[model samples]
Target: MSRTDPQFKLRVPAALRLQIEQAAQATRRSMNAEMVVRLEASFAKEQPLQEKAHDQ
Candidate 1:
């Protein structure tokens, strides 16, 4: 997606937000991009586990 595109908003705890911001700065990416990448990876990892549990 384009950087200018409308993005979804996620509300996180203050401490978590600070951690995300710090990581974003370290990675040289904006908070939005960093969060999206993290969340996408998490979901990708989780989906297979969820599917396996459902099949059991």
Candidate 2:
């Protein structure tokens, strides 16, 4: 299957931008992929435990 990539335009503080770049390098992932993964994980954490439990 062909996948279409999603793009986001974010305005981050300079310090946070540097941190993201560093994290991307440390994990050997491109900046875009690193940001997407981080955002997904962050949203996943905010999900209700009950909702997640029901999914399983």
Candidate 3:
């Protein structure tokens, strides 16, 4: 995200933090970017299920 984007403090467990750090390094992304990408993927995956449930 750009410097102008809104920012917030997040607190995660140390183990989870380490996992994110490793994943970020493997993917060549900042930790924040890795989190954002994973979060968005989760939402995208859930949306299809949500839409199917709404249709039923």
Candidate 4:
């Protein structure tokens, strides 16, 4: 992460943590990058639905 970006403290189960580590290695990304990418994609997917709900 960039120095200007904020940092957060998070805890994960062992199984999930292992999965994330493996995925990050496979994708050649840091664990933080992997998590941020997944979270951003998840929120982006949900944003459209949220907008639709607001319109209704």
Give me the candidate number with maximum TM-score. 4
Clashing residue pairs found in predicted model 4: none
User: What would you estimate as the lDDT of candidate 4?
Assistant: 0.95
TM-score winner between candidates 1 and 4? 4
Clashing pairs in 1: none
TM-score of each: 0.70, 0.69, 0.86, 0.91
Could you tell which candidate, 1 or 2, scores higher by lDDT? 1
Tell me how far the alpha carbon of residue 17 in candidate 2 is from the true structure, in angstroms, after superposition: 0.6
Q: How accurate is candidate 3 locally (lDDT)?
A: 0.98
Tens-digit lDDT string for candidate 1 (13-55): 9999999999999999998889889989999999999999999
**lDDT-based ranking, best first?**
3, 4, 1, 2
- Candidate 1 lowest-lDDT run of ten: 1-10
CA lDDT of 12 in candidate 4? 98
Q: List, residue by residue over 1-56, the lDDT tens digit for candidate 4.
A: 69789987889999999999999999999999999999999999999999999999
